[model samples]
Target chain A: MKRRLFICSFAMATQLFFAATLVLQPARAGSEDAKSSPTEVRVDNFTFSPETLTVPVNNAVTWVNKDDVPHVIASNDGLFKSKALDTDDKYSYTFTKAGSYSYYCSVHPKMVGKIVVQ
Target chain B: MAKNDRFDPSLSGFIEHDHNNDGIDRRGFLKCMAWAGTGALCVIEGGILKSYALGSQKGSAIRSHKTASFSFVQISDSHMGFNKPANPDVIATLKAAVDKINALPDQPDFILHTGDVSHLSKPSEFENVDQILKATNKEIFFVPGEHDVLNDDGAMFRERYGKNSKGQGWYSLDKNGVHFIGLVNVMNLKAGGLGTLGQEQLAWLEDDVRHLTSSTPIVVFAHIPLWTVYPQWGWGTDDSTQALSYLKRFGSVTVLNGHIHQSMQKVEGNITFHTAFSTAFPQPTPGAPEGPGPMKAPAEQLRSVLGITHVNYVQGRHALAVVDSSLV
Candidate 1:
């Protein structure tokens, strides 16, 4: 009986150690992926240039306004409004929820662009 | 005043001299005389004469009369703070527009500003436009161009201009026998550089025109082109097809817009889409280049290129003649 109890305890310890390792591995991998991912978006004349973009959830996206005129990084559902970004100005928003988000420049209605967060 | 009008007292001397100088190689002299005659004529009309000599050609002067017929003046893309080569003083050009409207022999019932009253959506810019427009004696209606709503959640534009407006300042009014619908498409733009009317506004527009008869003259105004002008430059609206779908039933539809800062017109069925020129500057023609920005011209030729659009709506006819006249 004593031998059996010792073995059972050892097995349980090993199982918990492996479970902890499994959980920690994803966290490390996420950090690594973020380091490799592109986080900056360029807002140029009348376009987001890259019409569709994919980024990990919880990762931040920074939009840099490269046009001479002003632009707003606003979500379709009123999720965000970056106000007016002048030339070379920047606005950053993090995606906490995983979903496709669309946005546009409220000033120039025709100037529309979107982003997808996964 | 009647004799001065017909005789053109300023040209009386030149006409008399050219008639008598027949012995001086009349044909060659006529060419030189014509050149000299144009210069002398400028002093009579105004010191600032456009060299294009468009004014020299005698066209029937526009006859203005105050009748019950509905008329409205359209002013778009004022760009008040713009100080670029396309136009140096946008404010001055706008002032000239106001003057031109006031000087019209028959004053319009109202003035409609399609959008882009300010260059950067700044409060000061709005303030400047307000002060200048106040000089006019007619009522002014406005819609936002993307530039005017760039900052402050469009608070500055709404607070100043949206007092009686509905749903982000989008509303419709009945003037004479026409229905005027002002729409907002710049609220939420989409990727691929397309203008959006959003779901809410689209529903409202559908319902707004539901009760009206198909024979009613409908005039829809917005900042972005309702039809595709140049998608590459972000000049076209994404859901414009949805908007135009509703108006397909109308007998006479006119869509007036301003954003591209150039003049272009298209006629589809009963709908006529016209884009106005910017009081600020001119952009490159579609596909002229890979990008869109203020296009500079020779310094002396700038004003002649950047002009205003004049529209005449004749009663008892569906024909609308639009003429774009430069400041020069």
Candidate 2:
């Protein structure tokens, strides 16, 4: 009778352990994704801070203008265009497919930045 | 003419013209005006500039001046999208300019906006300027300012205004016996560099003007000053010398510009270089303590410093008579 009780308790504990693992796995994976995606570039002093950025597919990248004057981020291939971003203005675009994108400021053409998506 | 010169100083001003073949006579008049005052109207006749200040002894002498063949208004640096404290309401100021143009005693044949029609190259901003300018009932010509070409290499601006223009939006039009060349120099800027007319545009310009007679009056308008107005602020054009070389043969070459946001005039040989005031905001003088940007002054005085230019092309004048007036 005691042996039967021990077996039954062990089975219940095993099932509970499996249930816990099943619930925790996706949460762990989701946090990892949130950590991996880097999605921002800063504009200040007439330049993009991370002139080159890398991101995952379907991730969005935001460009925030911190300069006193105005700026614009335009893709070379006519993919994306931002309006004149005055101070504190922000522009964002999502990378749906994996590719490389190059852009420059329309005001200051010398100011350029690149993005690579994997 | 000699008998009348002894009694009237204003008549003596005309005597100076007889000696203008030497080019020293105009310089002497400029020196006299500098010592007298800056508020004076100067008329160029047969290559001589005669000054007549308002209420001066010679002011009425200019009233009998011959009628102009045609006249046009020059509005620059409207900067419609700018919402900063320096000039929060650019649209209002631009409207005032249009009102000023509409109220002119003689309606202009057309209007030439030197550049900077928008502050941020926003499509909405362009549309706003178009809407306001439409109220003037005058045809408008546009060249891209650096600000106008900020997005997609000015793809939006070119689409709207440069549809009939060549690459980078440089084109020429012949109107009423006058040849007007609109140039693009604000594109492809270097680091804090001066404006440039690339080799492509320069070649095109040479070919464009090749067939025209030297007697044809050429009006070249661009965003930045073709001359080195103030290189320290990147206010000059790099390849303008080459562009001006193509125009040297012309009897009257008027190069009008508008980046400085203030009125400044210079005459070199047959070329008359004039920079107009902005309709948006005034920038600091080139050598002021602060570098170039929107400058803040007394709020009420802003409009008094920002305005448009009126140019009259008299039939026999050496060049256009440029008059700059503040909105106030």
Candidate 3:
């Protein structure tokens, strides 16, 4: 009986060890995603909310149009460009390098925004 | 100023027809609007606004080309740096328009470039337009298009050409007993919506025309159509009705616009709305294809589709003879 009890405890210990390993593996990935998850820039009221955003290099930034009109996103340095984004439309671009990128709505020139990837 | 005497078809009989006929869907109405590309010339006669196609000869009762007191040329949507399949050589076309204006039988007193002076809003693009338009040598007045205000909120445009403008590049001037109002409506465009004049600009416009005599002839020019042309493509203005309310008391009012890349005209009460063709490229007629954008016709037909407008205002008669001739 004692031998059987010892075997059961050993099995339990192995199972717990494997479960802990499985949990830790995803935990690391989850933290990485938290860093790289796309940051959002809302286009509303003819202005970009949080006109300036900072993200890690290679992170993705998504611009979602919340206004009723259409807007196009084009970077000043000609790094990224988007089609006419109508209401609720979204455009995302991932920065491969770190630098300051200025963008404006091609439809509404005065509506400008900036993004810093570091 | 009674509604019954108003010249707007919508206020007269068209609105009634629109409601009574269930078969005329929105698409059908848009199909009618497509013919607006033919160009509508709004003429004020006997204190009533009337619009007819520029080439139509049916209006013999009101036809009077006897004399024109003064004339001006309107060139719009030059899009200087635009290089696309639709129009690869925007500069050539703009130069052609300038040549046409220069060769007019009578040199236009001045030139009114409605908007879209540049495509990418680059300094070099504006410079290209400046060099080309210098050939005309006529006093030029400009209002900002959405494209012109792109990078610096029109600070560069204001610095370069809009020095005399009021807030956001809107202003008024008097020329030969006529009041010309240059309005900026493309500043804060609504999403998937038409242009907005904003409350501030509207208030200023109200005050600007408040003290003017009812007999004063008014000419209001902007980038977008003051009337609702096509809401689906943001072709019209949002608060234009309010802005226009101030001018209804005037005996003659002519509103000129550009941005649809095609010509269209409408007459409502004392207001005569006329849109001009772009010097860069032609856009699809409203509801012609899927939507409004750069439309490439046969390469040979490009010049025929693009053109400039010559407007002649008679002093006492209040008759405006608008001639739209192609660059070809």
Candidate 4:
């Protein structure tokens, strides 16, 4: 009886360990996905060609200012600020939240662009 | 020759035939002949000869010599470089407007161009506008519209027109007992929103109007509507109240703006706000689903829809009449 009880306890412990591992697998995969997923944006000619962008939550988005003029990648919602990126400069931000983000060039207010994290 | 004769063809024809007649020298006879020929040609051009002659006269018929009465014309949204379907050649339309102003019986004291002188703020675009406006006899005043500040930092506009302007091209001038103020709100536009007059400019504006008496006639010109014309497309100014509050004490305040490419007027107590139609193209009205572009109408209706404004300020009376007339 003692041996049987001990075996039962061991079996329960193994099952609990497996359950915990299963629950933690997705969390680990989420971090790995964030590290691997990189969404790129190109800014050119006083406008962001794809002015409206969409990306998966936890993905990193990069803005490359390919134009001669300087631009600011700033979110109105205060999510990020790429302080005055000059020509050929780049800025990246990891969007961990899911929502629509509207941004504009602080220097040139007429220059506006948006991003959607889902 | 019969004296006091209504039709003495024989006498006149003889005078025409003879190189010298009635002691009028050969050169005098030739001059009279040229004048008579031109008059006859003008008469033949239209049935209403008097009206035609008066129509050829330049400027507004509202005389400026009447002591205590002065007038100026307002033309907005010329959009000179725009070659879209809304207007094939805005320069030609602007020329037509200039001709209209020139044909007025009394020339305006000066002309005010509210904004959007160029479609893209391109150097070539501004240069073209400069050449065309130079033909006009009246002095021109300008303020920057959102479109004109699109590509550059308003360098092209500042270089060309804003010689004596201050603080993002806002300035004030006094003419004919009235004060004129030009404001710059199109520089720093907001997102899915209205234009903005920054804090510094607002402070300056407050101080500028503080000294003026409540009865002073104030003419305020800007690109965006000081009152909310439409908020969805960013047609209104964000801090217009802060600007308007300064002018509220003035008895006669005229607010002029352009951007939506349509004519609209509103009167609030002592203030009268007016928007002039574009000389280029017509945009969709407020809340139209067309997404802020030149709305092409039926070919027959295009000219009637596209129009310009004529502002006449009667001195001492505080009466300003703004008439909108179409190119067609």
Best by DockQ: 1
**Candidate with more favorable, higher TM-score: 3 or 4:** 3
Q: In candidate 3 chain A, what residue range of length 10 has the lowest lDDT sum?
A: A22-31
List where candidate 4 sits over 4 angstroms from the true fold.
Answer: A1-52, A56-101, A104-113, A116-118, B1-68
Cα deviation at A36, candidate 1, in Å, is 16
lDDT of 2 by residue, B218-304 (tens): 999999999887786677988899999999888888888998887766666677777887899777666665545576655766776
Q: Which residue ranges in model 2 land beyond 4 Å of their true spot?
A: A1-68, A72-84, A90-118, B1-42, B45-66
What TM-score would chain A of each candidate receive against the reference chain A? 0.67, 0.68, 0.70, 0.69
Q: Give the TM-score of candidate 2.
A: 0.71
The superposed Cα distance between candidate 4 and the true structure at residue B315, in angstroms, equals: 2.0
lDDT for residue B323 in candidate 1, whole number 0-100: 46
Judged by DockQ cut-offs, is candidate 2 incorrect, acceptable, medium or high? incorrect
User: What TM-score fits each model?
Assistant: 0.68, 0.71, 0.69, 0.65
RMSD of each: 14.8, 13.9, 14.1, 19.8
**How would you order the candidates by TM-score, starting with the best?**
2, 3, 1, 4
Report, in order, each candidate's fnat.
0.46, 0.23, 0.05, 0.12
Question: How many steric overlaps does candidate 1 have?
Answer: 8
* Per-candidate clash tally: 8, 1, 7, 5
What root-mean-square deviation over C-alphas does model 1 reach?
14.8
Per-residue lDDT of A1-118 in model 1, one digit per residue for the tens?
Answer: 9996675565455434433332211122123445466477787756786767788865556778776667777677776667577667776665555799887666555556667877
* Tens-place lDDT digits, model 1, residues B1-328: 0000111123111221112222222222121111112211111011011112223432123223233265677789998887744566888888877877777555677888889999888889989999998998778889998888775546778889877777787889988778899998776565445777888898899999999998777889999889877776778888999988998887778888988876665555566667776777666667664357766655555555455655555565543444455555
lDDT tens digits by residue: candidate 2, A1-118: 9996675565455434433332211111112343366467888655688999998755557788765568767777766767667777776665555889888775665577899988
